[model samples]
Target: MKKNIIFDLGGVLIDWNPRYFYRSVFNDDARMEDFLSTCCNSEWIVAMDAGLTAKENIARGQKTCPKYARELALYDEGWHHMFGGAIEGTVEILKDLKKAGTPLYALTNWSAEKFPWAKKNFPFLDLFEGIVVSGEEKVIKPNPEIYKRLLARYNLKAEDCVFIDDNAANVEAARALGMAGIRFTSPARLKEELSALDNRPSHK
Candidate 1:
């Protein structure tokens, strides 16, 4: 079977970062960094991504950090400000793979509430044959169960899939589960690495 390509959406294909939105929210870079690190950090995001509704997360954040209530609420209200657009180089690669008939899929750690916005903004997301979102599943990556869910749902053998993720832990999890893994750094590097993987003789 031709290798099925699984992509991690955020850093790999979409340029999503709270910093982009927060930069405009706070005038001082130091203050912005401190606020992000303190209240609206990655840990908080993980909870939202792991099936907690944005409304719930925002409320919890406000309760825990009342000083930043406005900022926390803005996290959901001004959510569109977080996007920097598609990584065009990676998008071009996706188009090429589509042309070559490679089965494509996405397994992303994204909030379910905000995913509709992404679907509307990024037409390229439609290229995927399937998308397993962490928020929808209530499970996040670097966890073997989530990976298994994707394989089982798609009826895909782990060995037949090539998972690409920007997070080292996520890529390692895929590799541990018998899927070929690529730690995505740049689109150029990804293209070269994927080409090399494709050229290799399949074990089956």
Candidate 2:
């Protein structure tokens, strides 16, 4: 049987810059420090990915500090830019996986707003068998609950799938659940890793 391959969006498929917005919106050292301290963690984005509306999230950003509202709106608008670049070899790798009949999915922690930007920018994702975003599911990664939900959704055994993620914590969570998980070091390395798996049963 072919194994399912799950991808994380931000780092695995779409290139992400951790400080893109801060660089764009903040010129002050103090405000930048404050912004980074208050509104820059994955949790805030995860909350939106887990189903909080973008409008509300902008408000949430604003509530963090009066200066944040405008920047937050820019954050929402520039999300496409935030996640615009594709991993160099990802398209080819995904194509090969499809050719080999491996079931493919993407499990990313992104808000409901992400779909529009992603679909508009990288519409090819519609080709995948499943795409789960935590914002849509109200769950986020590195939390055991999200991995369980993915397993349950596909009715898949924990060991029957391989998860690829850039974050060590998320990858470790998948492994802890008995799934095969690999760290995504880079697009080139990712292709090398997935191609190496062709020697396994799923590739056959």
Candidate 3:
């Protein structure tokens, strides 16, 4: 069977990092790193990924870390600055897959409130037959349930899907559910790896 391709948005297809935006704010790498690690870390942002509204996360962040109130507010207001841009190499691969009539789907850990902006800005997103968003589903990757949801919603068999994600844990989670999991490193590497799997059954 031709395997269905499922992609993770951030880190894989889109170049997104809070540091991209914060670099401008702090203008100092060390200061920015300190702030991100100490005050507004992944814990603070993961809440939004797990379905807490960005507005609510910002408010709570500001209340808890009053010293960085302005920065916290800017986190949401200037979230677009976080994008570096689409990974052109990977995008080209996506276009090729689409041209070949491959069934594509997207599973992303993103905020529900901000996903609309992503859909509007990234035209390449239209290539997907379906998308499963963590924020909307109130579930994030590395959790088996999120993977299960994607398979269930799409009526896809795990053994017939190719899951690609930048995070090792997320890839492992997909593998646990019987899907072929590829840990994204770069577009060239991904292209090579996928080609290697062309004649084989779905396997990591």
Go through the candidates in order and give each one's C-alpha lDDT: 0.93, 0.78, 0.92
Which ranges of candidate 3 are over 4 A from the true structure?
201-204
Candidate 3 residue pairs in clash (backbone atoms < 3 Å): none
lDDT for each residue of candidate 1 in 1-204, tens digit (9 for 90 to 100): 688999999999999988888888887899888879889999999998999988999999999888888889899877788889999999999999999999999999998888988999999999999999999999999889999999999999998899999999999999999999999999999999999997987563
Superposed by TM-score, candidate 3 places the C-alpha of residue 139 at a distance from the truth, in angstroms, of 0.8
**With candidate 3 superimposed using the best TM-score fit, by how many Å does residue 178's alpha carbon deviate from the native?**
0.2
How large an RMSD does model 2 have? 3.0
Clash count list over all predictions: 0, 7, 0
Cα lDDT tens digits, model 3, 24-60, are 8989898788789877898899899999997899899
- Each model's TM-score? 0.97, 0.84, 0.95
Q: Output the worst ten-in-a-row residue range by lDDT, candidate 1.
A: 195-204
The parts of candidate 1 lying over 4 Å away from their true place are none
Q: What's the lDDT for candidate 1?
A: 0.93
